[model samples]
Target: MINVGLNHFLIVSGILFSLGLYAVVTRKNAVMVLMGIELILNAANINFIAFSKFGNLGLTGQVTALFVIVLAAAEAAIALAIVLNIYKTFNNVNVDEIDHLKD
Candidate 1:
């Protein structure tokens, strides 16, 4: 424990964002892709909160971060529901295999 600081938070956020991007690009599973997107969003959220708490941005950043967290939850729910519907229709959760949309 090296007494986490602003730089530490930034580094963690960078790593999280990179890993999330890699997972999204390398994974073929729709659910995993969605999870990676969520991870990226969360990494950004962490950065916001860190700057809000440790930096001198005051409460504005905190309020914005709160809103972002709420939106992230809502987006996750809606996206997961859509992914479930896709899985039900295709019997698979692979993003590249979802092209049989009939009218």
Candidate 2:
């Protein structure tokens, strides 16, 4: 039988964070960037829960993770709305192309 430890969870979270960073840096589309941000937020949540479980923090970590999830949801909602408005105004959602304030 194999036992999972904090190190294992940390490793997974690290990988997720890295992938999220890559997506955010390399993707030109605003939606992809938002997805990457979500991945990064999820990675942070994983770390919070893992550390809370391994440490002596009781349910604090879990509560923090829940708060993070709520914040991420709200952030996504607002960001998507802004992106939709941007698209409607510019007819494009490419981050690189939407550089000018004046259209």
Candidate 3:
């Protein structure tokens, strides 16, 4: 039997955050960047849940994680809409390629 502790959760969260950051920094597609942002948010939620469980906090972590989820959903919706519009206008969804909104 293995005991999963806060350190274990922290390590997982750190990896997720790092991967998210790398995706955001290295990907040229807007959608990939959004996915990376979601990954970062998920990593934060993991930390929140882990701390809430290990630190004896009552419902705070869960509540915060829920709020983060909601926020991430809304952000994704709006960002995708913007990306679609940009694609419609510029015929490209690449973040680096669509730098100018006006031609």
For this target, which candidate reaches the highest TM-score against the unseen true structure?
A: 2
For candidate 3, list the clashing residue pairs, or say none.
Answer: none
Candidate 1, 20-103: lDDT as tens digits = 999899998988998898889889988998998898888877788889889989988998999888877778878776787742
lDDT of 2 at 96: 89
Q: Which residue ranges in model 3 land beyond 4 Å of their true spot?
A: none
TM-score of each model, in listed order? 0.86, 0.96, 0.95
Q: How well does candidate 3 match the true structure in TM-score terms? A: 0.95
Worst 10-residue lDDT window, candidate 3: 94-103
Worst 10 residues of 2 by lDDT: 1-10
Those runs of model 1 whose alpha carbons end farther than 4 Å from true positions after fitting are 1-3
Residue-level lDDT of model 2, residues 29-83, one tens digit each, is 9999999999999999999999999998999999999999999999999999999
Better of 1 and 2 by TM-score: 2
How many clashes does each candidate structure show, in the order listed?
A: 0, 0, 0
